[model samples]
Target: MMRHPFVLFALGTFAVFLLLHLAGGRQYVGVLSGTVVGGAGGAGLGLLYALAWFGAVLAAPVLLLAGLLDGALARASRARP
Candidate 1:
């Protein structure tokens, strides 16, 4: 059975969370301006922030273009003699 895109995205997100949690458990800290803090938390937070920013900035245009391309391809296929 084909899984939905959102479902796949959720699974991928969960897997990344699990991997990050297991790898270090947030003991280490990421360095910024020679300061130390929770590494996993900092990295995870940054990654999530970046993903959210990118989704906001690019998701709509990308999806719209994908839909238009799919529609065009579908039309071309149907036009085939």
Candidate 2:
């Protein structure tokens, strides 16, 4: 929902993460920079790894926070009337 922008962003990032993994980016994910060198495929894999890492580390937290905020807002609204 537009009201919960973070929830949407997190969900979108998570979907991208899943897509990266499904595209055979698992081995490439969580790897250090310069670990794999050479070719266009290598470059693509590196990008995928970066995206997946962000999705896991960044989006997950945002999603949790969004849920917490949504719940708190719900409670506050309910208490008002």
Candidate 3:
């Protein structure tokens, strides 16, 4: 089966969430507590937050580098005979 990067990212994010829930109970509780006071809603809200955080933390850097590499390659190709 072919697994896309988004699928992998989501699965990895959920796995990290589960691991943290199990191992970093206190820290997770603190985060949840803050979110609760800030009026964060159900699992959907949490998932959205997780996805956004993962995108910012992980995906953004990779995307930025890909863009930079693409630009550099294009510039190099244009400069070729």
Candidate 4:
């Protein structure tokens, strides 16, 4: 849903993983693979997975804050009469 920014970020990260896998199996193929950074690419996935995980974790709080703010605004407006 449009209200869930974390989901969008997660999907985007997954898309990146797919792209990396398509480009070639890790092994410092380029700046795109996590192997280039000396990470979990040994299994053909590292950077992209970590990125998606962190992005979602971080975005969850932001999404929650936005929801809280919107709810507060609605309640405040209703009390104005």
Model 3 TM-score on a 0 to 1 scale: 0.47
Write the residue-wise lDDT of candidate 1 on 1-81 in tens digits.
224454355445556555555665334333323344555666555455445445534564465556566667777999999
On lDDT, the leading prediction is 2
User: In candidate 2, which residue ranges exceed 4 Å CA deviation?
Assistant: 1-3, 29-31, 67-71
lDDT of 4 by residue, 1-81 (tens): 344454454566556655665654444444353335544453435444444445545654575667666667777999998
- Where does the lowest 10-residue lDDT sum fall in candidate 4? 26-35
| TM-score (all chains, Cα) for each model | 0.36, 0.64, 0.47, 0.39
Query: What value of lDDT does candidate 3 attain over all alpha carbons?
Result: 0.53
User: 2 or 4: which has the higher lDDT?
Assistant: 2
Q: What clash count does candidate 1 reach?
A: 2
The predicted structure with the larger lDDT, 1 or 2, is 2
Candidate 2 RMSD computed on C-alpha atoms after optimal superposition onto the true structure: 3.2
The 10 consecutive residues of candidate 1 with the worst lDDT sum are 25-34
Give, for candidate 3, the lowest lDDT window spanning 10 residues: 24-33
By TM-score, rank the candidates, best first.
2, 3, 4, 1
3 versus 4: better TM-score goes to: 3
Off by over 4 Å in 4: 1-45
Instruction: Give the C-alpha lDDT of model 2.
Output: 0.71
